[model samples]
Target: MRPVPLVLPLAGLPHRVPGDTDAVVVGGGVAGISAAVVLAERGVRVTMVEAADTLGGRLGAWPHTLPDGTRQIVEHGFHAFFRQYYTWRAILRRADPALGFLRPVVGYPVISRRWPDEDLTGLPAAPPLSLLALFVRSPSLGLRDITGADRSLALELLGYHRERSTPALDAMPAGKFLDRFGITERARSMLFEAFARSFFCDPDALSAAELVAMFHFYFLGNPEGLGFDAPDTDYLSCIWTPLADHLTRHGGRIRAGAAADTVEPADDHRWRVRVAGGAQVTARHLVLALDPAGLRGLAERSPGLRRVGPALAERAAGLRVAPPFAVSRLWLDRDVAPGRATFSAVTGEPTLDSVTCYHRLEEPSRRWAATTGGSVLELHSYACVEPDAAQATARMRDELAALWPETRDAVVRHQLCRYEATAPSFPPGAAGARPTVQTDARGVRVAGDFVELPWCAGLMERSAMSGILAANEVLAEEGAAAEPVHGVPQRGLLAGWTPMTRRRR
Candidate 1:
């Protein structure tokens, strides 16, 4: 269950590059920050440009004035900091060496209206045992469901082969895969579908191969248990500001609020990132670490970029953005039931997928609640069908009231709703067409969750791993040693067991 070394340090290699090894990273998300941190620490002159005024992109947090004139930090969305995010935690260590800001979420529950809640916490980390534990303890699943299920599909789920499984199941939808796997409807709704919708994609629109990969990465092959932790404060204070200071401490320059307009070529340097204000950052290496839509737009804007990095531009063009998701943070005039879980993954609702009682989770939110005798609640719809923010917010609120019951009478003093299409989508038959860390482009690498990686990682970890891999590429070109990367167990537990079973028979 130990992490496998995907990238290892080499002998007879220098730790740092020459003093003038310069790089410019576009986008200030995990991907860009990771690349900038690694390069800057290794003596590269790193310049990071972010469109937003803050460092974290999707994970960004900013100050907001409540109706009572209370200043509070509002987050863009909620994210679970899983224990298995090796590279991301390494990068986070630059900000807080001890990572004291994180607090463990006690239980992982998928709550539904039709059946009772299914808790995914305390499951064994390794597969076979974990799989057996789920089958044994889960109220939604039973021995009858196992006996009635498709054995082949069940075996395939157990044996997730990166090289073969993806091509085999890439053409099928996740919904169809679950149906074929013969899991009961109760299990499908409370457990499988709840997990599927977290990618901001409907099960019918998501790829089955992607679903299997996620199952392996998050639950089956993970050495870390199902429990995860979250920041007790805000990202701006605990994560971004400190990490930004860490970057500048090592001679890295950050140009916040500077949007990269065009990526133009330079005769003296490898690339120049031209910002909105006519300021340009020229560097020997470039990491285009933007969201799918942002990267595609930049590629389209800079037609000449096709000449230097045709593959990067083409991959950007083909990358798909997931459906719009919504986050609605409500300042409730009353607190929910005291015994409610701090965070819960919700299912069986058309518009609501998850809800977090921020007052119970974070320090500032707790302070606000304690002073005002109110609660800070955040509702999310990962694959929201509604486009309008207000309408989506209303729907999620109504759904929350239906589930929680106590929220039916609570009045919302203030609410902030946001709907955007920022996450990547993995559609059926869309593998191998996406770009990886090392593009065919000269002196250029792309780092994002949308970009295909060779290893198994979920959302934030995927971004960080890609960023580190991109930095390693730059380090290789500069003749400096590459950073080591770790990954969860690559193959599934039952991968080679089929052959053994046949041989024994």
Candidate 2:
């Protein structure tokens, strides 16, 4: 089946020559790379500039030497590859046609300190049945809990009515929606709240519409089940380096460590982007595949961007960033029990939200574990309230000990902690205000997870999808066929039984 068409309306862009140096794509994240790759494949000369020395942006990793003289590549955190991420998979397939670098995670495991040994597995793969199995088998939930839920909200969640339900869900907070539907406090905390917080947004602050959309995307609408996959190695070797090679092979230029300081319109009608250290390049089209903060910084510093007028400035100014999040990785001198899960969702912990046994899941770490008989664990905290890295790390360690007592005695051989502000917040009523791929400024497009995508995907998938849409926007202006973007169907059974079915009968 063909992918869904994006609803990007670029009415007034002027056609331009698709020649060498035709486009300058800023920010070398997934979005930037995706855009650059598409442009280069279409025989458009594209120059990609990245502030960091690497091309992965948030997905970038840096090498760190352990005290024992071993080196490892430290990353921001773990990333899950859901099956519905068609565009991202397609992009990866361009480099590695076989997609041999990914490893599947067999089951979804949600754990709590209150019951560390509990087996929260065996939920059926298919939905309605899966939902039923979960409710039936869960130790925390009961029949009364399901019966007490508000019928209308439950129906809206299970019954697919995109036109009528999307706006209604968008108007309320996810926490409020759960409370209104009478979802039990324990059930909410264990499942819904944990899932919401995993995305770095508190349930009370995030949009109910976004939560519902994710439910459909990851659980209900999914064809490959709720299980996810992850890269078998560091993102640098597996994803970024390969993509960079692919882009260059397709005739695209990449400039690492070249930070674009400002982007302004030149006298010749082309956009002049000035990099740090006095380097400058002019291109016919510019794609700002930057994060919200980066975009704001560009607009604030560049007189050219400001001169584009109030509409673009207002949209950029209105963008909201979520609170800071933190990731901590520990190298222990002892191994976790072999039977313990490789990855798990954590609740009832003060600072730790999830944990991954990298030694079990990643090939490099697995080989290291075999040699040293040790373990490598990564802990994550979303929307962290800690004031400093030390405090966050301390809390995470203590919580980790609480959940897995073995960690308390495991000697730390090496450790790394990172705290930074990341991802855009999806607050109640924030959907309509989010920017799209096309901006009011001519020849300028934006791509990021925060941008309003036509499809219901978020995080890394959203970033890649937005990149595809951004490139297509420029292609449409050049009178080229827009690239197809894929999205999973949201309406399951309802999709098969349309009004036309009744009319035909």
Candidate 3:
């Protein structure tokens, strides 16, 4: 089905007509695209340069197929879309109208050996009110168990919202918070191994403040109608189409495989970029939308950027990209009994993390089955160990054999692909320490998910927003009237409060 079209509200500012001005945009990820799109719309001639052959850096690598070439069983990496992602959904709707956004029939199930086998069945049909409601209401835990630390269960979950005001929560590990709540040993094990592996991959290692911030981002303010699930469409085709189409229609240029090797600040506050192919391009404005690590190559070109170099280097240093979390999607060789929109077999078995049937959606059962062919069963399990491609293959085969009794013989063709860095790790106040968009140099500016505000939760929407901000900074320097992009407006980042302004409606 085609996705619906949408009209994104451009942050309106005074329109200043430039005299044949050109801006160079670095990186081709969501952040870069977002900034490029906004600038193009503002009549800025943007030449977006990407080092990779593709636009999406890490994001493009995701939603890929396995050896046997199966389809994605879950939502896109980067970030799972919900109703709250107005900007993201607007782009998808504009791209194609038939893209159906369907919430999973079950709430995200937290599986553990201590829970009952059937406990993960279709999560209770409670309207998502808050993170606490979503968690406290799940069949996995009892109120008494969660509220044992405090007299009031409501206070226990939501009341501590203010504890983050102090530095202790930022310094505390998630284990400390869980212990204070008196969470069961089984629950803790399950959260760290099974549930977290599905996203964070190392919940125990993640900071309590970052976790609390995530809780706040999802459930704090926008408490109504917050259900979590996968989108019912192709990942890139849904969001990228509209943004790309808009840029193309506006005479904006996007050239891939043109990795920018160096960017030198030229006279008159303009910049010159030397790409890998010996191609040289000069622009009055420049946007550095590449990641902090990726831009390390440019340190020699822009000397003024040296001050922010350490901050950028520090972010790159701490990055432990989640080694693709183990998830195997099995396509049954033959048809089997089909029912419901999504059927998950969460038997609470440590090895058998979860099973999903692709034929459950309203799409033609025969056609959908044809997509997977030979019947389909998608299996998801936590990474038992660090994944080495060949070793993971062998280990997946062994795990499949142990979990699916019928799969030992009946299975014909199956594919395995790990969800690489499904979610990025942001320690407490890490978002606050994000590098400045504007460097000490007059011309160069930064944009990307790794920047302060949006990518904290590591979602596509955040990166998109960051891109818009990055572009705005460069455009503004050229005396062009662009809206200021909003970064997370809070104190305690590095030291003083630095505002991250991105285009907003």
What's the TM-score of each model vs. the native? 0.98, 0.91, 0.73
Instruction: Estimate every model's Cα lDDT from 0 to 1.
Output: 0.90, 0.78, 0.52
Q: Pick by lDDT: which candidate is best?
A: 1
Model 1: lDDT equals 0.90
Of 2 and 3, the candidate ahead on lDDT is 2
Clashing pairs in 1: none
Report the C-alpha lDDT of model 1 over 1-505, residue by residue, as the tens digit.
8888899978888999955679999999999999999999999999999999888989999999988899999989889999999899999999999999999998988987788888899998888899899999998888887667778777777888787678778999999989887888888898899999998999999999999999988988889978899999988899999999999999999999999999878887478788998988888899999999999999888866777789888888998899999999999999999878889999999999999999998888999999989999999999999878999999998888888999999999999999999999999989998888887768889998898999879999999999999999999988899999988898898875543234435
Highest TM-score against the true fold, candidate: 1
Q: Report the lDDT tens digits of candidate 2 across residue range 23-137.
A: 8999998899889988888877899989988778777876778787777776768888776688788888876898888888765677886653333444455567766766787
- Would you list the rank order by TM-score, best first? 1, 2, 3
The window of 10 residues in a row where model 3 has the poorest summed lDDT is: 496-505
Global fold similarity of model 2 (TM-score): 0.91
Superposing every Cα of model 2 onto the true structure, what RMSD results?
4.3
- Candidate 2's clash total is 0
- Residue 369 Cα positional deviation in candidate 2, in Å, after optimal superposition: 2.2
Return the candidate ranking by lDDT, descending.
1, 2, 3
The candidate with the higher TM-score, 2 or 3, is 2
Off by over 4 Å in 1: 497-505
